[model samples]
Target: MALLAQQLRTPLSTINALAQGLIRRADRLSTHDVQVKAEKIWRASLRLDELIETILSYTRASAGGIMLNPGEFHLSELIKRVCREQGGQEPDRPFHLDVKDVPETIVGDPILLEQALVIVVSNAMKYSRPDQPIDVTARGEDGMVRITIKDRGIGIPERDLPFVLQPFFRGRNAKKLPGTGLGLSLAWYILKLHGGNLEVESREKRGTKVTLMVPETNTTGLSYSI
Candidate 1:
C-alpha cells in the first residue's frame, strides 16, 4: 500500500503540476515546451500502468490463482520466441541466445513458463547496458532442465539477495529503477507452480546470474509425449 501510495503521488503530482503549468503559461509557452511536458505525462501514465499490472499479478499469485498445464514442446523454439518478445520490447538492445546441452523437448505450461522467462529477460534489459549482451543459456542436468540468464548490469548487493524473491522488496541499488519490485516474485510464484525453482547469484557491481531449474517430466521412461 505504501509503494502504491508513493507511486500515485509521484506521477499524479507530475501530471497535475504540468497541467497547471500549461494553464498558467497558455499564451507564453512555446509548442516545443508543451510537447516536453506532454511526453513526461505520457511516461508517467505508462509507469502507472506498469504499477497496476504488477499489483494485479501479485494479487493473483497471492490468491493461489495460478495453475499449470504441462505438455511437450520444443524448448529451443520457446526460448527463441521469448527472447524475441523481450528483444522487441527493447529494439536497440542485443541478446545472445545460447542453447547448449538443452533437450530438444520439454514438458511445461508454455504460457506460464513464457511469462517467467520474459520477466527474467526484461529484468536483464532494465538493469544492464544496451551494449552488454544478455546471455541466455540452457542445458539439462540430473533429470532437470536448467536455464541461466547472465546480465552484466548493476549487480544486486549481497544484503538484498535473500529478499529479492519477496514482493515489493527492492534492492538497495534497484531503488532508482522504475519497477513495482514484483517481477522476481511473480516469476518465482509461476516457477513454483510448475515444480521449478528460481536461483540467483551476484556480486555488487560485478553482475547477476539467475538460474531456473525444473525437473524433466518423468513419464516412466517415456521420452516423448503421446
Candidate 2:
C-alpha cells in the first residue's frame, strides 16, 4: 500500500497542478460550465491526494515505522492550521477553537502533528451534527500539553470506546460515517510515538471528548499553572 501510494503521488500532483492551471485560464474558456468543471476537478484532486496520504500513513504505521520531520512549532498555530484545513473541508458544519495557557513554542514534528490533529478534528466534524459545533481547546497542565476536541453529536458507546483505538475498528455510532476506520487509530499511534496518548470520554447521545496529552518542553514546563 505504501508503494502504491508513492506511485500515485506523482500522477496526483500533476493532475492537481493541471486542474489549477485550467482554473487560472478560465477567462479564456467559452462557457462558465468549463470553469466550474475545472474547479471541481481541482477540489476532487486535492481530496484524492489527502486520501492517498492517509492510506500511506496507515500502512507505514502498521509496519511499526512512521516517518516524521520533527521541529519546534507553536502549539496554538498548529491547532489553528489543522482547524482551518478541516473547516475548509467541512464548510457545512461550524468549528470553534480555544487555546489557553499554551506555550508559544514546542518541539515536535509539525507534519506529523498536523496529520494527526487533522484526523482527530476531521472525525469530530464527521460524527457531529451539521448544526452542532466541534469544539477544540488546548492548555498546559501539570507539565503536559492537553488538547481536547469535543463533538456534540452521537457519542461512542461505552463498550466500543476501548476498541476504537484499534486499527480498523469503528464504533457503532460511527459505522454510518464514511471512513476506513483508521484515522483515530493512526492518531493514537502517532501521539504515542511522541510521548503522548489519547484520552477519550464519551456518553451515548450526549457527546464525546478526545483529549491528547503531550509532555511540554523544559521552558514550558516551568510555566505550567493548570
Per-residue alpha-carbon lDDT of candidate 2 for residues 45-150, written as tens digits (9 for 90 to 100): 7656666787788888777667545567888988988888778865777877888679878887777777888888877876777778999999988778899999
Off by over 4 Å in 2: 1-46, 218-226
lDDT of 1: 0.79
Predict model 2's lDDT versus the native.
0.75
What shift in Å separates residue 157 of candidate 1 from its native position after superposition? 0.9
Give the winner by lDDT: 1
RMSD of each: 5.7, 6.8
Whose TM-score is greatest here? Answer: 1
Every model's TM-score? 0.77, 0.76
lDDT of 1 by residue, 1-226 (tens): 8877887678778888989998999899899998988888876775576567667777877876656667888887888898987787567787888886888888778777787887888788888887788989999988788999999999999988999988888898989776778889888777776667899898888889999887667322212110
> What is each predicted model's overall lDDT from 0 to 1?
0.79, 0.75
Clashing pairs in 2: 141-226
